[model samples]
Structure formats: C-alpha cells, structure tokens
Target: MCGRNATAVYRFGRPGRVELTSAALTMAMRGFAGGGETQITAVNKDYRYTVFDRTSRTGFGEGGRHDTAMSSGLLIQRAGRTVAAKACSRDATVSAKAQAIIKPGPYVPH
Candidate 1:
C-alpha cells in the first residue's frame, strides 16, 4: 500500500545520520544547565562530550528500589555543533542506537 524506506534513516558503515547536531546538543545543554532559559557558557571551541556511566537505576513504578539496570548517554555540544563523544559503552552500540538521524557534517572523522 505505502512505501517506507528505512534506508533514508540509515547509512551502512561510518554513519551518515546519527550524531547529534551542534544546535540540538546546545539546546539540550542550555536547558539542563540554565533551566532552559538561561544563557549557556562556552566550555570549548570544539564539540566535546561527557560520557555517562550507564548501568540501570533501581526499579520504577512500585517495583521498589531493589535492582534494575539502565543505560545512559550524555549530550555534548560545541560552538553549536557536536563533534566528539564518549560513553561507558562501545561505539558500535552508540552508533546503532542513534541510527543516523542527525548525520555528521562533511570533513568529520569517520
């Protein structure tokens, strides 16, 4: 009936649409840093990311804080662009999860 092309959303090898854009990362950072209304400070000239250690947090919704695991990732931005990122996990998983949604800019390292 309808045609759906997942390829448009995916790029085999080296990712073409996954990494976060500079603006997206900046907005997120600003929101988290200044309550979504305050001006954000410049930490660096190049895009930098702070990786978070993901391992699941306790339980949720009446499950009681017994034991649960969760994975997490931190967003980093540079002068409006996200360049590099680091996480407690491997690049493969990160690359897969993001699924080429944003697409790294040209001249970016593979």
Candidate 2:
C-alpha cells in the first residue's frame, strides 16, 4: 500500500531502479480510475518513469461484473522511447489506502 510517505520501487536492467513516491502513485491511481488509457509520469535527472493503466469491458457484460479487464504497469523511458516495462500481477491486491485512492467505479471489475 502506498501512503502519503510510501513509495513504489521498480528495477530494470542490471542495477537501474526507479522509486516513485506516493504523490505520483496517487496521480496514477486517479488516472486509472478516471477512464480510458492513462499515463502518469515522473522524471528524475534524465530518466522518465511512467505509470500506465488501461480498463475495458467485454461486450458480453451488461453491468459491473467480472467481464471488465484492467491492466496496470510501469515503464522506464529514456530519450523518447521505452527502455523497460513491467506489468502488475493478475492476483495483485491493494491496501485500503490505495483502494480509497482508486475509488473503483460501478463499471470496474473487481
């Protein structure tokens, strides 16, 4: 769970790592819950860290259910292209603090 002081860490390559504080994570969560595909970015020196999420519902569903698919991950970009990317696990669980920030809508598949 990411709180006001918490941070998310991502490692790429041999020793490259990026740490995103709660502020960026919160923005990413909000972007994810808002709708459509979103990308929230944070920069440190010359590296850009981008957090992205995409949500869509299957045509077979009528209301909020398991028919919706949600995907979230992080990307490391240098120059203007991606250098590394990682996806959240399918069984990932969120803490209450993170959940409050996400505020899943009725159309969200929980």
All candidates' TM-scores? 0.24, 0.48
For model 2, the local distance difference test gives 0.50
Model 1, CA-based lDDT: 0.32
lDDT of 1 by residue, 1-110 (tens): 01134322211123575433223321111122211111111133465443332333354556453454544444456666665554436421223322233333222211
Compared with the true structure, what per-residue lDDT tens digits does model 2 show for residues 21-74?
A: 334332334433334554445566566666566766554544644466777777
Model 1, position 16, has a per-residue lDDT of 70
List lDDT for all candidates, in order.
0.32, 0.50
Flag clash pairs in model 1: 17-100, 17-101, 17-102, 17-103, 18-100, 18-101, 22-80, 22-81, 56-69, 56-70
Q: What is the lDDT of residue 5 in candidate 1?
A: 42
Residue 52, model 2: Cα distance from true site in angstroms: 2.1
